[model samples]
Structures are given as C-alpha cells and as structure tokens.
Target: MTALAGDRLPPPLAEGDRLTVDDLALRVRVSGRRKRFALTVETDAGLTLHAPEGRPAAEAEEFVRAHRAWLVAKRGLRERTRPLNPTKRLVEGEVFRYLGRTYRLALVADPPAGGKVNLIAGRLVMDREQAGSPAGGRAALVDWYCRAGRAWAGRRLQPWAARMAVPEPDLEVRDLGRRWGTYRPGDGDSSVGRMSLGWPLFQLPMHLVDYVVAHELAHTRVLGHGADFWRLLRSALPEYEERRSELDELGRRMWMGEMS
Candidate 1:
C-alpha cells in the first residue's frame, strides 16, 4: 500500500516579525542578550521594537501603545531631518549640487547622439532628449553623480588609507539610506572588504567628505568609536571634532533637500 505524504508547515515567526500597534506599524525584534525592551527610531528604519527574549507579543504591543506619544514626536523629527525624495520636473534653471557647488540644469540639443549629462561652464548641461522627462533627468543626474563620487573617493582614499595603515579597499557609491558611509571588513574566505559611501556626499564640502572617509578608514582598525578610535582619528585629523559638528549641521540641510 502506498503511504500518504505529510503536509509541509510554514516556518514559525521569529523575533523580527512585523507587528501593528494602533495606527502605527512596527518591526518586532527580540534580543536574548538584552535585559529590557527598547524603542529605536531611525531615518531609514522607522520604528523598531526591541524586546527581551521570551516576552509575549501582546505585552510588546502594550508597551508600544504606552509610548505612542514619544513615537509620534520621534517620527515627526525624523521626517523633518531625513532626505527629501522630491518629485523632479527636470526643467531648465533647476539647480542641483555637485562637489559642494550649485549647478543649474540646462538643456542642449547637440551632435552627441546618445544622451549625456555634461558639467560645462558651471552648469549641468544635458541633452534635450535625456532631459525630456523628470524621471529620465533624475536618472541621468544620479548616474553622473555616482561615477563622480566613486572617482572622488578613490583619490581621497589613497592618502587616508596610507595614513591609517590599512589597505585601501574598494569604493562603492550608492544611496545608503540614513547613513553617510559604512566600512565592511572582509571575511577571510569569501567576502572582500569595501567602503560604501552615500552619493549625497557630493553635495557637501570636500573637507566633510574627507572626514567621512577618514572616519570609515579608522573603523578598519577599531570597530567602535571608543577612546582608542578617537585617539587614532585625532592623530590623523586634529580638527575632526569641528568637522564632525559641521557635517552634522550641513548634512541635515542636505538631507532635507535644501540645495542652497
């Protein structure tokens, strides 16, 4: 006689499940290592609920409800500070930033067959065909920025890597959400280490970009921002503190979509 097959079951939900509390939706993350529940608000990851292992989901929901007021305020603050993903019209006279300089967008009809964006005479000139729509113009602009940012970082990385005594890793320019940059150390077998920098860095001054590069390079030695990390960073940049403060102020404005 033939045996009947058993039905496959779905995997059980773990700590990092999505939970809805009132009008808000939150991510539930359980940490066996933590002693208490915690709430963290980030620009990229909105609301995260960190609960100690074995806590009931119902209790977690109640905790979130209790902190609704705080969550509302934090959400508002993040919305104000986070980068504005504005809808672009891609029209002439629109201003965009490059290497901390303002460049007005201008359309040009040219012999160059394929569409391209060129920085000419302090303006971002694009082929009329490429700048025909908002989406196309945005794509062209972002593509150009990514290429420029990678090259710029490569030049800065050489000196900073030499000073930090770390081998220069690969550079990647992309939208890193809320983070400006991150250093990922390579695992021996499979992973090759690299630095991922936010494309928005091009909007800031060169000094600020250098500071970010230096900060990530320091992570190659020390993983955390401890005293040793600060000491090493200071050895390389004496005015790191001031630069950091300035970046923080400027970064908010840049993220908020203010080009001026």
Candidate 2:
C-alpha cells in the first residue's frame, strides 16, 4: 500500500470525485490519485459521497455531516439483508434453495475415460473417466455451472420478456468482477437495447437470477429506479421487494466457495 505524502496529507477531494446519484439512492466511494484526492457519490434519490484517501478524518466526517439528512433517509431505505460469505459456502452435503426448490450439491468422481456430465438427484455427477487429474474435478464442476447458467437464463428470460411486452435483450455470460448484471439501452430508442448478465456460479436461486434479469430489463425503459421505474417494475413483479431482499442476503453465498 502507498502512503500519503506528509505535505499533502490532508488533501481535499476533487469535485469530479463525488457521490453517485441514482434514482433510488445516493452512494459514494473515496479514492486518491498520485497527489490529488477524489470522492464519488451516487444519488438519484438523495446523495452519497465518497471521501478521498489521506484526507483528514474530521473533514471526511464533516463532509458526511453536511449531507446527514440525505444519508439518513437513504440509509433507512437501503437493503439491510446480508449476503453469504466465503467461509460458510461448501461443495457437498449442503442444501441450496433455487426457484423455491432445494437441491443438494453432490461431488462424484469420473472414471478413467470419458462420458457425459450431469446433475442427478441434486448431485453433480462428474465423469471420472474424463478426469486428467484430481484438480480437474473442480474445474469440471464450474464448467457445468457455466453451461447450466447460460441455458437457464435463456429459458427463463424468453417468456418473461414476451409477457412483459419487452424485447428480450441479448444475453451473454461474463466474469464480471463486481456487478452481476447490467443493462444498456440504445441512446434514446427503447426498441434497441443490450444487457450483460454475469455467471458467478449455478448455486444461486433461479428467482434471484431472474430478478436481476428483470431489473436490467426494466432499465431498458427506465434508466434509473425513479418512481416511474419502480412502478413499472412493481406492475410486473409484485414481489420485487422480497426478491431484492433475498438477493441482497443470499446472493454472495453462491459465489463464496470454489472461487474466492
């Protein structure tokens, strides 16, 4: 880690590096460049401001204090659910809930040759015959998950899009480091749009995955979660709040093991 210089120890954050304003909430992240300080805040609803690194602690607190009312209001509306972390996730003998159905993670060794791979009786069956080494087993499992995830997304999003009277956006699997999914509509044409869906693994519930898809799809019409956007989303999925809560809590758990 790099340390701040003594002379520039208390640099003030730049205006460009401020909070983000989304339709739903305002949030920010603080960072510092070589010799300058920066803050970022996002707020479509209220305001979120990020503090720059190496800034005086008091100044950072004061910055937040200046926007305390907005912070308090948005914080109250923020999702409070917790996500699953790396330590608690496992491969086998674990019960996972997806699409309201429970499945168990099963690890099976393949023979020395080759065959098909599948998940049977809630257990992921590996073709030991195709295994070149013991390490390949985990790789094979993740591959299976990627394949399953792509196919699953296609199947689920198709009908939903048709019912919602929205054209299905292009779907692709990605190894996004931070976001699970994102939507990008054409400059101004609602008819033209694009979306990217991430696949951390297949352990997450299908509803959560669908919720993300729906969220992104809604962005095709509403760029941000303003009142109109939320209203449009609610009209389609009355239980969106519950789904969001579920994802906020259990989404990270799915990616806990075999990755981090």
Candidate 3:
C-alpha cells in the first residue's frame, strides 16, 4: 500500500468564504496576521468580515449572527445615504457646485474664438461652443474645478502646515474614488511628501476642507489613527469631530452634483 497522500496532509483551511446573516450577505476573509475578527460595511462593497487565520468557519458565522442587529441597522443607513446619479448633460440652467455654493450654467457666445468657463455673477458662464457638446462642457468644468481646487489647497496648506509643524506637502487635485484625500510620504528623511485631494472636496465648506488638510498633515507626524493622532488633530482643530461628521453627511450629496 502506497502511503496515502491524504494521511500525510493536513485538512485545507478556508481562506475565503461567504455567509448570510439576517438577509445581509457577508464576504468573510481569513488572514494569518489578523489577531482579532472585525466587520466593515462600505457603501460600494457592502459587508465584509475579517477573521484570524485557521479559525473555524462556524465561529465566523456565529459572530455575524451575534451582531445581526448592528449590521442590519448600518446597512440600512448606508442605503439611505447613497448618492443620487444626477443628469450629466452639459446644458444651460444646469447646476454645479464649488466651494459649497451652487452655480447655474449660463451659455454665451461672447468669446467666439476659444471656449472657457468662468464663475461670474453666481453663474458658471461658458462659451456657447463649449456648452453645446457634453464632452466640451465637462472638460471645461473639470478644468476649472481642478485649477480652483489647487489654488484653494495652496492657500490653506501653508497656514495649516505651519500650525501643525510639518513641512508643506505637494498638493494634487484629482478624483480619489472613495477617498477624500491621501498622503504619500517620501522614501527617506530627504524626501518630499505629496498629498492628493479629491476634487469633490470643493463641494464642501471651507471648514470641512481645512479638516481634511489637517488630517492629512497630521499623518506626517503619526501614520495611524491612534490616540496620538487624535490628540494632535484636536490641538489644531478642537471641533474636528463635528466637522468630520458634517463632511460624512454631505459627502454623498456633494458627489451627486445636484443643486442644493
């Protein structure tokens, strides 16, 4: 008899699994480095559970069942706060947001040669040619937002960096998907840091904008959201928690691009 392969090998462990709890489906992932189990609910990704490696699958299912009430409530809240997908056609009377203000689009033929966008008299004025085509209109609008976002960040970063005692990091405004901003630290002591802020931030108020900047700057001192990070952030913005809450509430609406 050949020494059976099954007798010499250990049973396979589940690295990934899925289960349903109270009508909510959860994606379970087992990680070798995870010391404890945790659950995260995201707007786009739904529910996910992380368990310590080699833990019995039955234990993970039981954990979900234990927190069934909390999971159901959180998922319901996420659905209520989901952003609306507004019409994207570039047309006159359409609304766009900037620096927490809504401006209506106004198409004009004053500048016949080239197309441009400008916020004048509470209106986003655009050349007729630019407004006639969706691509042209979106490009002009996005270009304006990018320029304005950079200028706005430049003005705020200097003061905040000085207050936080961190070197001013390079700023880049772009779509950051689900994130408001990200801080990329350089390789070593001699490296310069870079911070990429989402253009959607322009749709929020200045106080909230400052909170995001301060949050990223604080990362320069502490990498994680430990007690030290909160302490440092509080020293700069005492009401940061309030601002953060407001930001979260307004986040979906801002991304919707609808008139307030």
Q: How many clashing pairs per prediction, in order?
A: 1, 27, 0
Q: Give the TM-score of candidate 1.
A: 0.65
Top candidate on TM-score is: 3
Q: Pairs clashing in candidate 3?
A: none
Per-model lDDT: 0.80, 0.59, 0.80
What lDDT does candidate 3 reach at residue 236?
Answer: 91
Ranking of candidates on TM-score, top first: 3, 1, 2
> What local lDDT does model 1 show for residue 98?
77
Off by over 4 Å in 3: 1-71, 112-115, 256-260
**For model 1, the run of ten residues with the poorest summed lDDT:** 251-260
Kindly report which residue stretches of model 2 are placed more than 4 angstroms away from their true locations once superposed. Answer: 1-83, 87-117, 128-136, 186-192, 257-260
Could you give candidate 3's per-residue lDDT for residues 1-260 as a string of tens digits?
44476675432235556766657788877788998778888876389988887666567778888888888888888787766545555778977888888888888889534339887888988888877767667767777777888899989999999998988888998878768889998788998789888888887888888999999999888888999999999999999999998888887666532222
Q: What's the lDDT for residue 70 in model 3? A: 84
